[model samples]
Target: MDERTVRKTISQLAYCYAVNRRVSDPVQFSIAGLTGKAEKIFNSYPSYSNWDVNVSNKNLDELWNPKQIVYLTADSNNLLETLNEDKVYIIGGLLDHNHHKVFEILVNFCQSLDWKKAFLNVIPKRKGIGEEILSEYKKGEEITTVLIMLSLSGASNQPPGTAFIWISSILAIIVDCLLIMTIGLELEKSLFSYQSLLNWPLVECIFSSLFAINFFISIWLCFNGKSFSDDRTSYSLAATFSLANFVQYTLNVIYHVRTWIAEQKSAMQVIDPRGVGVTSYGGP
Candidate 1:
């Protein structure tokens, strides 16, 4: 990595770190397998001195516990369904087009060890910056990939720390967080138990929100038109599919909350058979 590339990479890394902190939950950041070139760049930027950059030559297997590992690969086929607080995510360290090679090798190495492994898909299925850490930087600008892992969670429903956030997924996550918060508030004020909220149709809300955002954005673009960019086709397809899916998953999340509340009210009467007029409010 040249001096310019190192500086740009650090700036992007800093931006990613800042984004993670903005979420309700923040991800922990660290770098491993640092080359001498990268080290010199880090030394130049004293501001990032506190960053956890591990220089150990220990292979990934010896360094991290397999049970707690989640590898964020550039491959789309390995989409991750969910994220947990207990796991540590491993991302590739090259910023350019060749980044997938490292992750592929790492995956094979882990498999060779017979270690139980979990793969996650954080990046979008479409072509683009799968590891979004380098999104802000211009193409052909100085770039070096850094491996970051979120071992713990302050994140919301999904993991907070990510190298990339798909344009489509970002909308869905924001909407999901809002829905969860609203439902939580409703649950707190009433006599309902946690069990009642169990199949609350959250997945429907996620898809609905994702599609709605995409549909609207696409419609707006069609009217206003879009400036030419490298990834136009993927963006167009995302918009088209979003519009189609929007109407498909229209089950209202609020309806489920109301139904749950109504059920709780009926059950409350049975719990207070004496008719003492006792009702429950959320307590600290």
Candidate 2:
């Protein structure tokens, strides 16, 4: 997470807290592990303090009982049916990336590198952003490969609407590449005057939704144009990939939508009079 993400999170938290108050739900929102950008954001924004947000420069365990705090993660096998009104739940600070065992492993390994002695023949000391290792979830490779096959097969085999398939496939590649560039890139700030108005899931939702329609249209053309019905191996292969990508895009849309909604709900639902941390992480 960068300063922008952390700032956005605090802003969203404030928004949710206000919403909760409007509904007569008393909730205490706490932010722990305040350092670097986090501390700066907290201190600079008097509104946060005014909002009655609990701020701390410590870890969750240092401030709260371990058993009372539930740290939410995607890979947790223990499914929590519902939120316990008495318990405090912690959500990771980053918006797109979920912290799990794998993330811990990578972060630990990265942190260890800075401790190695240069002439000890151990791994050389280095400092780098570990979370960047598992940045964005992507299905572009499979999708792009499928699109290529579809376009090529249609063109070589001379299927009906071959031109349409080729043009659409090319456009699809452009969209996929655009999505890829957004990962670990500052295009939002550089390209848009209002960078705060943009976020990953929203951008992803738009792309996936548009591509879902694209895939649907392509699939329809495939069936009626005999791209799928053709007896030739080329057309069948193209149709197969096209269908697969369509399903993938649809799933992408559903996944992003669910993620966005859950974020909103979780942000608004954490009600604690004493206060509890939402998450702790690096910010720029």
* Candidate that scores best on lDDT: 2
178: Cα error in model 2, Å = 79
User: At residue 276, what lDDT does model 1 achieve?
Assistant: 53
Q: How badly does each model clash, as a count of residue pairs?
A: 6, 1
In model 1, the number of clashes is 6
- Compute the lDDT of residue 202 as modeled in candidate 2: 49
lDDT of 2 by residue, 68-122 (tens): 9988776887644334567877866654332222222222323333211111222
RMSD of each: 21.8, 32.6
lDDT of candidate 1? 0.48
TM-score of each: 0.32, 0.32
